[model samples]
Each structure stands twice: as structure tokens, then as C-alpha cells.
Target chain A: MTESAAAPSGPGSTAASPEVRRNPVSTHPIASLLIGLLLLASIFFALYVPLYGRLTPKVGAWPFFYFYLLAFMPVMAVVLWVVTLLQRRFDTEAGGPR
Target chain B: MSHVNSTVFTIVVAVFILVTGIGFAASRWRRTQDMMHLNEWGLAGRGFGTFITWFLLGGDLYTAYTFIAVPALVYGSGSIGFYAVAYTIVAYPIAFIFLPRLWSVSHVHNYVTPADFIRGRYGSRGLALSAAVTGILATMPYIALQLVGIQAVLTVMGVGADTTNTYLKDVPLFVAFVVLAIYTYLSGLRAPAAIAFVKDTIIYVFVIVAVFYIPAKIGGWSHIFGAAQTHFTSTNPATGKPFGTFLPTTKKVGSTQLDFVTLALGSALALFMYPHVITGTLAARRRGAIKRNMSLLPAYSVVLALIALFGYMAVADPATVASVKKTGNAQLSVPYLFQNHFPSWFTGVAFSGIIIGALVPAAIMSIGAANLFTRNIFKEFFKPDATPRLETRVSQWASLVVKLGALYFAVELPKTFSINLQLLGGVWILQTFPMLVGGLYTRWFHRFALIPGWLAGMAYGTLAAYNTSSPTASHWASSSDIVFGFSLYIGISAFILNLAISVVLTLVLRAFKVPEGPDETLPRHFTVEATDTPAKERASVTAGEARPAPGV
Candidate 1:
């Protein structure tokens, strides 16, 4: 029933093929963490944010909750993207698939 | 221009054509020899890669209820709706722990459904039947809720009548659903799996654009928050009380912080128990895919967090409030917010996005429920020797029948109350947790014992939910109730009772040396990857043929 038909045939193993090793590369943790922290900081700054100068008129339809929730996507995406990288790193260092 | 402009009509037509085409094409996706097999039909050959899986699961988890309903709750009730946000946040991390294992065990054993696993593990057909019934019942209303979401979008777009009776006004919905049902029956799970990509793309783009554009139009973010604070903190003339906190001001707002935590925790435990979610997870090709995706899927929760905030944005915008008040339908809050602010063409785009969003999940939920009926109830009791083709046929018809059933509920039932029942669906689905999730790690609890516990939980959950009357309906009106001198999530309480019964019954059953069913899983099978072949082939197959889990 599974697509494991194309992979090496094994009854008990549910992992990727042996040669498919390293599980497609991902960005490293160092780069990931830097991006995440920076994004989080931006979100915090934006929170309770008031307009500054001529830009004082908040962009149209850009309400707080809408902005905040919408803003969460990319911020969380970067963080998750980083965590994914870090996890892949750990997975690799731990000797790839079991 | 009196009618929908050509562009609006064209967009709607395109969506309909594309969706219907996918539905038909899905019938042949992957072209399994046994097109009629439950695995092939209900679970889309159960071998989706990461990208497809992501889209499929997204479509499953995030529904039109999610886009329309969550924000509506935010628009209507304020902070209480954020429970959705919190629940979604925890759902993935919790699933990460058990789902991969469930997938592996199911994969190795060739289990078709969660109930199949329960029966194999505990050797109790009765308990499996209960799980099947609960899953079907919970999922039916959920499928119905998607129809309601579709109807809401359709009605708002003027695709339905201006003042027609609700049913006649729902013709557009009925038409779209008939098309959906046919395609689902014809194609099975593949249609939804393929369409999820389209659904998620539209939702992501629309939501992202709305989040940025809507805020800038509504005055700055601070001013929006300021308006919301001023509104919620103000005294309610009718209740003579403050409206509500944008965030929970008290741990015990209707539910204790413990209740909130327990509710979140209980729901996290229950998410994958919903047959559809499992259908999505198991449909994946690898256990690592399941594990890795769980970690990755939290990114959507961030999207969800934003979705929840749209309710607050509705509160802040005076024009938006005026539109919602004139409509007197809070369900229209998010849609009207867009209609009032966005250009007409973009509104059409947003409307289509929401409608498609509902359709993708509706297709999956129907398929999941159909699989449960076919595999667990129909096959187990009606025809043990039923062929894959027969099973697929039964499910296809059954999916159509179930959609019609949900349509009736959507049209006839009080929408708010049934939506509450969809929450009650959580309580129902959670009953299967101990048997399905617990059985994965340990067989300590006797299967028979677990059954009574599950029954007790179901009874108590149903009663507790029924007795929970709010301002509108009597009985089954609210999800919270007092238990053990504390307000708690009814699902958690019932789950505890269920577990207690299972534990006590297991102890009693063990003393009698009752025969337990044979477990198909080898111990190491739970921890390792399941290769395509049986253990016998390891010596003969190509290199890297997975060894049979040693020592089982």
C-alpha cells in the first residue's frame, strides 16, 4: 500500500532509501537562529507600535490584529525554517537514518 | 454590471471547472491496480510525498470554519476564540510524538484505519466498532461545517439569492457539493490531496495580502488595538459588565487556566484521533516524513494566530462593524470586512479563496469518514471478504450520502449549535485516543477494559455537553462544565473517566487470563522504518532490504 515499492524492499523498515542519505540538505542552524531572533525582535517592535513621521498614517487596511496575525506567518516561517535546519543538522550529526 | 461582472463569473467558473477536473483526474492518480481498494481510494494510495502531504494536511486541518469561523468567533466573542489559536499551536508538537509511530505500525501491519489498529492490538471488534462509530459521527458534522462555510461564502458573494429561503438560497452550495461528492466518490482521497496545493496557495496569498493591506487601511496597528481595547473594556449595557479581554485577564475566565491548559492538552491528544487527520498523516510515505512534518507544520499555527486576529480587526473598523450589524450575522464579519475595504475584484478573489479552502477539507473529511465506514463497519461486519473494488464502491456512495446528510444538517439545524457540536466532535473523537495512541506504546490496558472506559467517557462527554446550556439552546449548548469542583474541558474529564474505566477493567480482565488479540507489530517495528516487503524477502531482495524487526 505504501510507495516503499520503489525503495529497497524491507518488511520492518519505514525509512528513506540508504543512498538517499543526508536527507536533502538544509540551511545550517547558525544562519537559522540569527534570522529567527531578528524577526522576533521586529515583531516585538511592531507590537503596540505607533506611526512615526509622515508615514504616521498606517498603511490602508493594516489594522493591528490583522497586521499582527499576518505578520506572524513569515516570522514563524523563518523560525521554523531555522529549527528545521538545526534539526536536520542534529539528525545528520547523529548519523542520519536509523 | 447588475449581475456579477464577467471577471467574477469567470473566476467562479474556473474554480468549479478546476475542482471538478481534479476530482475526476484523481480517480486515476498513481493508477493503482486496485482502484477500488480502501487504501487507494480513501487514502490516495497512502504514499504522498512531503509537498503533497503538507498541502493535504493543511487542507484537512485548516478549514473554511478556520478562515470564517475562527475570526467570526473573534468578532463575536472576543478573546475566548483564541482558544483555537492556542489549540492549533499545541496540536502539532503533540502529534509529532505519536503519529510517526502510528504510521509505521499501520504501514508494517497493512492496517487501513485507526479502528483496524485498535482491533488488531486489543483484539476487540466491539471497541473498534465504537471507535468507528464515534469517528463517523464526529466527522459527519465536521464535513457539514465545511458545507456551511461554503454556503456562507456563496451567499455573501450573491451567488445565492438576495432574500430567498435559506435552502433555495443554498442552491449554489448544493450544486458545488454534488460536484464535490461525485468527484470524491469517483477519485477518492486523491482529489483532495491534489487540490490541497491549490487551496493552500490561494489561502496563503489572500491571507497574507489581507493582513498587510487591511491593517494599513484601518488606521495604524496601534489605533486598531486602541479601538479594540476601548470597545472590549467598555461596559456592556445589557450585561452591565466589561465586554472581555483581548487576552485572558483571568486564568479562570469561564474555564480555569487549568481547564484551558487541559482543554488544549486534551484537544492536542485528540487532533490526530479524528480519522481525517490520521488519514492525512498515514497517507504520507515515510515515518520520518510524519515526524519531520509535525515539527514543520507549526508554521501554519502562526498563520492561524493571524487568522484569529482578524476578529479584532473587525472590532476596530467602524465601517466593518456597520456592515456586520446590518447583516446581523457575525459569520459575515471577515468577509464583509474585505468587501467594505478591498476592491470588488479582490473581494471576488478572497471569496473564491475561502470557498476553495472549504472544499478541499470537505472532500478529505468525507473520504475519511467513508473509509471508516468501509473498513471498520461495512467490511468488518457486512463482508469480511469484500474486495478492494467493493470497498471503494461502498465508500464512494457512502461519501455522497454522508455529504448529503451534512447538507441537511447545515440547512436545517441551527448553524451555531451544530458548529458547537463540531466542537463536541472533539469530545467524541478524543474517546479513541487511549486505544489508538496508547496501544501504540503499550498494551498494558486490557482491550476490553479500554472499551468500557471509552463508553463511559462518551456517555459523560455527551451528557456533560448536552447539559451545558448557554443563552440560546438548552442542553448540548456549551463545551465547558463543572467537574470535581472545577470548571474543566468536558473532553478531558470524560477522557479521564474513560481511562479510569479502562485501567480498572484491565486489572480485572487480566486476573481472568482472557485471550488478547495477536499484535501484528514487532517491537522494533515501532522504532524502525517499514520497508515494502515482508521479512522473508530480506535475504533475497536488493541491498538495503529492510530486515524484519529482529526478535519479534
Candidate 2:
């Protein structure tokens, strides 16, 4: 069952790997790199506690730590939004997902 | 009874009934021809677009855990509690890397649970069972924690029976659980998916109101932070140290910067791995919905950051502090803050949101755990010939059983015990990362090796968590322990150990030429979108795919 079901030929050839075979990254390396960097930047900024974990640099009444956390969410939303667009463009250029 | 406000109690009860009615009506929301199939019942027909998916996943993720526990932690421990905000922020980017792949594969193969994908990819029922068991075991305590959240709100409202008997006192909790189970049984995934709209609406309304109004009422953000800093830095008569950190320091003990970073990163990795979160993810109609949600869901974290500040708000308001100090449970801090500051009617609305917040996630969680049981354990081992109808029936029954178990955990065990187990749940679920997430990118890790690696990590995580102690408690006291003299989250440490063993054993298994389990999935399965293959095409292409061992 496992052996035979795995080799499904009809939908397998058409729906699955056409874009992957063309390799979206190889064709649009800069877009892929930007997406990667944007994602990494989002994670890096949030995880690096020391960068925002201070007391003095206050925004309004919030300490720097508190202010930074509240501020970081919108920035991350925008970063991921950009990454999504890049991936969409890259995937479309590489013969699209559908 | 003396403490109960009739107005608040009536309002809360009314809102709860309205939400319950919504839950019962949800079965018809996205009507499907066959409600008995696992995909329809368990995964909401796998047809949720970006909008509903956002609400479902947000309601699933933010939870009562966000509403009550995080504020309570911040109230008690100070800056360390903000790890939750950091965790939610980083979790999106981390999930963005892999969740869409999981979605695509699950969509292509009609997989309803993470364990189903593991079983299909690794071709090892044993490995799949481990993933399934871990998912159920981990989810039980989480569902229990939501009950704890509900109980806290009831306790604050002075709503439960005045009886000295423990079970009699929890009449309200039992009532809540029964309604939840019935609606979930009748409506399946659609029930929670529908109620999530109401849950999130009430939550956003209350949280935004509280963030703005509470601060304005209690002076302002500066005053709240200043009061919190003063209170936290002051010496505690019990411990002879400061109450907690006003700001996380580079010091060796108590909410260090290192501990903060590790907790954030570790929890970010573990968040989406939970079966309930994956259940929410796989329900999306398109893979792109998952990616878009990865960016969109952080909007909730903004509210989470505001909610965490409620701890400081509680500290800043003396009436709230005094009320909570009398109870001696930090969990009451946020509830007391609301009761003390808000008008009776608004307090009722906020309390209802808290109760319903617990319900939405609890429903999703029970369904997720049930799917894992039905797909990987029941059908895999007992009834391989079970029809889709039978699978959905088993899942519905299993969800009821899971909720009952959670009810027992919440009512019988000490609250601290459930809290400790939830912490361990985070650790236990991370052990499945090697198999679930690893198999997504590559199948290089030998399937046989994953079992022992998982076992070793589970064993070490359990014993280590057991040995951890705080000043007030001797066991199950903390989620982070010293590793190489650095305070690190046990989940991250156990995950590293699990990965190391997996790598070493894979090398050994490869050298011995052991048969790698059949790779049932092709690379294309990981990239396929729903529109890529029409339903008729998918059905014909993988004819009899749902039947047990059909090709054989």
C-alpha cells in the first residue's frame, strides 16, 4: 500500500513539482535572499533581548523594553508582508503554484 | 454570595448563553454535504480562507492563557513574563519558514492531524503513535489550564456555589464544560470556528478598552511602570530578596537576560508544534492563507503586550493589590484589577470574554487531540478499515473523553500540579519536533532512531522539571533549569538532546543499512496548493487513498 500509493502519477506530475523543478530561488536569487533576510531580521530583533531590555530609553511612559516590544509587532508585520509579496512574485515568475 | 454583584453575574451569564447559542448554530455555518468525514469535522472542511482562518488561529493562539496566565505571571515575576510577547513575535517568523509546507503536504494527502503526516512520511506506525500520544498528553494539561482560567474568572465574579464541598463549588465549571462538549459534538470544528468570531471580538473590545481606559484611570503608563518598578524592586519579607525583577538583569538568578532569550526562542519553536495550533493551520483553504496569517496574527501579540501590562496596572491600583493580596493567588491579580476598576456592566462583558476565551481554545484543543487519537492510534492500530464516518464519530467521542480528563485534572489535582504539567507539556511536545518538522524538510533522520531520541528527551525533561524548585515550592516549580550553569528553558535543552541523539543514531542506522521507512510523500506534495488539483482530479488520482492498505 505504501509503495504503490506513493507513486501516484496523474496528479503527482501536474500539481506537485512543476514550480519546484524550475527552482524559484535559482531564477530569482535576490528575491529569495530578501525574503530570507526579512524573516531572519524579524526573528533576530525579537530574540535578542539585550537590544531592547534597557530602562533609560523610554518611549512616553514605557521603559525601553516595554516600548520596544509594543513597537516591534508592526515592524514584523510589515517585514513578513514584504516577504510574502516577494515569494508570490517569485512563485508566479517560476510558473506559479496553481 | 455576599460578594456577588447581581448585575455583573446576570450580564456574564447572559453573554455566555448567547455564545453557547452561537456554538450550537455553527453546524450550519459552512454547510457541507458530508459532515462525517474527518476533514469536514476535524479540519472544518479544510476550506477556511484568510479571514476566518485569522480569527480561528488567533482565537486558538491568544487564548485564556494570554488573558489570565500571562498577566498573573507578569504581576508575580515582573519582566520575565514579557517572554510571552517575545515568544509570539518570533513564533510567526519561525512558523513562516515551515508551516506552509506542512499545510501543503497535509492538504495533498487529506491529512487531518500532524501525526497522520508523520505516519505517511515515515511509514512507521510506532513513530506516528509517539507523535500522537505526545500531542494528546501535551494537550490535556493545556485544556485543563483553560479551565483554570475560567475558574479564576468565576472566583473573581463570586459566581460559584458557596458550599464547602470542592465539587459542589465547581458547579459552574461543570456547566460550562457540558455546554462546550455538546456544541463541539454537534458542530465539530465549525463550532469553535464560528464562536471564535465572537470570542475574538469580545476580547479585542475588552483588551483595547482596558489598555486605554485602565491606564488613563490609574494615572498613566509612566505611573504604572513606576509603581511596578518600585514594588518589584522592594524587598520581600518572605524571600529577603526583591519581589521580582523590575527589569531583567544579567544576574545569575531570577529572570536573567539569558533565561529570557532562551524562553522566547524555545517557546517560539514549540508554539506551532502543538496539535491544536496545527489543527488551526491545516484548516486553511490555501497554503497562502497560512503564510499571510504568519504576518497578520502578530496583531494579537500587540494586544498581548497590552494585556501583560495589566499586571502593572494591577500593581499600580492599590484596591486591586489589596484584593489580590487577600486571596494570595497571583492569578486573581487581573480579575481583581477588572472588578476594582471597571463598572459592573463592563466587568461582566470582560468576564464573559475571559470564559469564552477559555472555551474556544478548549474546543479546538480537544478536537485536535481527538483527531490525533483517531487517526494515529485508533484507526492505525485497532480499526484499519474504519470509514471516514466512523473516524469522525470516534473523534467526537474522543474529544468528549479528553475534555472529561481535563475536567478531572482541573478539579481534583492542585492547581499548581496542572500548571506544572502544562509546563512539561511544552517540553514533551518539543520532542516531536525532530520527527514532525524534520521530516518536512528532509527524511535523513532514520525513523527508528527518532523513537529512542524522543524517549531520552522526554525522560530527561520530566526528571529535570521534577527536580526544579522555587522558594515557595519544592517540585514542579519552574520551567527553566540550570544547564551548564546557565538558566535555560527545559524544552530547548531537551530538544537539543533529542536532536543530538537523532543525528548520532541516524549515522549508525545508515552505516548498518537498515531500511529507511517508505517515503510515501513526494517533494511535490509539499508544494501543492488546493487549486493545483481539483477535487475530482485528486480523488481519481489517489483513488481509495482513505481505505486501509488499499493498494495492498
Candidate 3:
């Protein structure tokens, strides 16, 4: 890391290079992909079961739309955690990948 | 004006004064030798790391628009309004993929706005100016919408009780804006950056408590859910349509599961494209902070999801619904609900929470608009050798003027109409997708082709949105219009048109010898490792904060 008063600092590294580095690999991927699939199911139920003309019995005291949406949050979060892990290829260094 | 109790008003004023003092002092926060440069004024010296970035970006993102408008839409529309929730859920994964790359490239080039990237990438100031103009124009009304959010709180708080005159009704709002304008003018980005800490804390406390306490008071979760379901299923007397669907459907009404998914996807793609979010991201010290913040941001989204449910709570309570109907102001549903249910002190806390919620993002939006004006408009066309101090000065004044203009929008425009205009804003903002986000992954679209494509999209979106009307108001009331048999949000349809034109024109232009601009940015610039590059490398970066008084 030579100092050049006129050399450009590449975008992000000028800040902290903290001691506890983030692992490039996340906890899970296949699970994350599967979760995304499950989420589509949940979101569909949220939409179809409530909005569709004469669907099925509602989820709880809760209607399908309300029930599925609240339930979808945790599932969505899990899937995002997974997608993020899979997409770790993008957040890597300027020279790391094309 | 009972809700604006004299005691609370005094306290709010004193706190605002104290906060303003702290804000003006923030010019010196994390002190550097000089404070006149645009970097210091606009990006807060660009030295923020993760912790501060979280609060700052959080402040910039979850705005008064989300707090007031989302709940109102939910209250009025029944179920379709929750698209905001889904859009928010998807925004993170969407941002996680590209934001870090943007951070790297913008940092490397010292680009101040998204337009800066366009200008550098394609060597076209016209294209850059188009993007900048689009961002600023869309954002002005947005800032105004935040003002309307504050005014709704004020109107509910009884701050405007004495006056039928519009000017008098907005007195409290006017005072807040004046103070906000001054602090933002003096402190620049630091004003919002510091105030975000206070705003987020107030919001988290009041919202968490309200989410719990309100449900119990309304006869628990079961009763709340039951009431909402019953209400949505009932056919409206006016339209004979059930209020709205709480969920998506396979059956197409121009609106379907596909519409839901596409709107979510389109908005998720467009979220960070707004110049303000980029300004917030670039101010951070490293790329990792942006990545880390994406996961952490859902913590706020959880709060937002609860906030949306406030709409359901409003729907379930018959008295609250009766009151909203009497006033014909659904925007006051949350404010009225709090007033009726919560104790005075807690209501004040909640009141301050929503008011400050509007304040934080209002500051950021104005600053983002000002940056566009200074960088793309002022610098590009005016004195190319404009001093950093001059640019900063012009931006400061521009921010004050923008807020004042938005203030007029809030006070002067009818509430129902302003909301429709906000939908109009959603339409105009989506037009920029081709240049800002599309160009990130590929440059296959020629810049020449892209410009006309952008214009076509803007015209179609504006006209389609303008023509959209319902029984409630003449022009801007309805969000859905049938397009080719499917009910859809106008923004998505318009964006598809924009992309189609750009793609077709790109192939056509390539057939001739329309030269593509030099690519100063390489593929790696989009994926730079944070720790791998040292601050020492930046020593030669000519874009470093130039001296204030001299010719920059």
C-alpha cells in the first residue's frame, strides 16, 4: 500500500478494515433457494385465498391475506439471507470477479 | 389546537431550538481543518463507517411518506396497499446485489450523484442532466409530501384549529420548515445525519409501544383481524366494489399476482436509484458497511410492517372510523387513533415521532435535490471552474428554496390531490430505471437511444397517471388502470415501454456508426474489495476535497 498523493482511492476500502472480517461464504444457500420457493407459495396464498372469489377456509381467526403476510415475513427474511449468501459473488473486490 | 398543548408546544419548540443549535455546531463534528468544501457540507466529509451509516441511511429511507401515506392507503384501499410491505421486503436483496458495486465505482471516481456516473460513463452531460432533472423534479413533490405528512399530524394535533385561512393552518409547519431550512442550510448533510439518531430513537420507542398497546385496547389481535376482514368483504355503496383485496389473485383485473410481483420487483430495482440513497451510501467509509446495513435494515422494516398494520387497527375501531369519515380525512387515521386511545404524554411522544420521521427524510431529500442542482446543473452549465465553496453555497440556498416550494405544495394542494400527485411521482421516478440501474449491469443500450426512450417513458407515464381518476377526486385518485386486460400500477407499464424503446433503438444505432463513449469504469470497479484498497491510494485522488476559497 504505497502512498501516492495523487493516486485515486478505489471506492470503498478507504474506510475501516476491521479486525473481525466478514466471511465471504454465508451459512446456507440450498436452504435459501428452497425458502424463496416456499415464500412464493406463502405470498400466493396471501393473494389468492383472500382476493380470489370464494377461495378456501381462512387461516386462523385471521383471513388468508393477513395470516400469510405476517407468516411471510420470517420466510422472506430467511430467503433474503440465503439470496444474499448466493449473491456474495457481487459484493467482492473490484479485481476479485468480473 | 388542544392536541398542540401549550406545554408540549413549548417543549417541542425548546427541543427544536436546542436541536438546531446542535445542528449548526455539527459543521464542526468529527472536525477536519476546513468545512467549506462540498464534501464536508454535502456528504459530511465522506468519513462515515457502518454504525453512523446505519442511522443515516435509515433516516434517509423510512420517511414521513411511509409513515403517513402507507397507513392511509391501507385504511382506504383495504389490501392492495401492502405492496409497500412486500416491496420493502424485496428491496434489501435487490440492493445487496448492486449497492456495494455502486459504492466502489462512485468512490473511485469521486462522483457525487448518479448523474455523475452517467456523465463519466457515457461522456454526455445532456444525458446526465436529464437524469439529474428527473431526480430533482420527482423529489420536490416528495419533499412536499413529507411536509403534508407533518401537516396532517399538526392538523390532527389541533395546531390549526383557530384559523380557516390556509396560511394560519400551516403556521406550525411553516415555523418547523424555516428552522429545518436553516439547520440544513448551515449543517448540510450533517444536520440530518445527527438528527437521524434522535428521530430513529423516538420512532422506535413510540412505534413498539403503540403496536403492542393499540392491539390490546382494540380487543386484541383476533378482534382487529376479524373487523378488517368483515370491512374489506363488504361492498362499498359508491362503487359496489368490495373495498380492495387483501391479497394477490391469479385472476387478472389488470391487477394480479403478476402485477403484484412486477411492481415489487420494479420498485425494488428503483429504490436506491433515487439520488439521495446513493448520496447516503457514498458517504460511508467502506463497501462492507453497505452490505452489512442491508441485513440490518430489516430491523427497521419490521417496525414499518407494524406501522402498516396500524391501518388495520384504524379499520377495526368503529368510533375511529366514524371520526375519520366525519372529517373525510383518512390521513388522520393514525393521528386520530393515537389521540383517542393513548394518554396525552404518549400521544405527544407518538406525535413527535411522526413529526421527526418526516423531518429526517425531508432533510435528506432536499439535500439530494440540492446536490443534483449543484453538480449537474450549476457546475456543468454555469462556471465550469466554480469554487467548491461556491457550489456548496449555491446548494445550501437551493435546499432552503426547495423546502419552501414543497411547503407550498403541502399547504396549497388539497390532501386527496397531493396523494394522487405522489402516485404521479412514482410514475415519473420509474422512468429513470434505464440509465441508473440498467446501465449498471450492461451498456448494450446506446446512450443516444436511451435518451429518447427515457422521454417516451416519461410522457406515457405522466399522461397515463394524469388520466387515471376515480369518483373520489377528478385526476390523481386511482393507482390502477386496466392495461391490455390486466389491472396494473402505471409505473411498471411505463418502464416496460421505456426499456423497449431503448433496446430497439440501441440495435438500430449500432447498425450505423454511432460511437459508444469510452468506458472509464471497468468491471472490477464495480466489485472492489474494501480492505484490499488502502486510504493511501486516495492520496493522489484529484477529487479529494479541494481547498475552499481558491478556484477548485
- For each candidate in turn, the interface RMSD (Å) is 9.6, 2.6, 6.1
Model 2 shows how many backbone clashes? 0
Residue B398 in candidate 2, Cα distance off native in Å: 0.4
**Candidate 2, A1-98: lDDT as tens digits:** 23433455545455544534565667888888888888887888888887888997777778899999899999989888888887888666667653
| Model 1 CA deviation exceeding 4 Å by range | A1-10, A13-98, B1-9, B251-256, B530-552
- Candidate 2 chain B lDDT trough over 10 residues, lowest sum: B543-552
Residue-level lDDT tens digits of model 1 in B357-378: 8888888888888888988899
Candidate 2 wrong stretches, greater than 4 Å: A1-6, A9-21, B532-552
Candidate 3: lDDT of B525? Answer: 50
Better of 1 and 3 by TM-score: 3
Candidate 1 chain B, poorest ten consecutive residues by summed lDDT: B543-552
After superposing candidate 3 on the true structure, give the runs of residues whose Cα lies further than 4 Å from its correct spot: A1-61, A74-98, B1-15, B531-552
Ranking by TM-score: 2, 3, 1
Alpha carbon lDDT at B387, candidate 3? 77
Better of 2 and 3 by lDDT: 2
lDDT of 1 at B401: 86
* Candidates' RMSD to native: 7.1, 3.0, 5.8
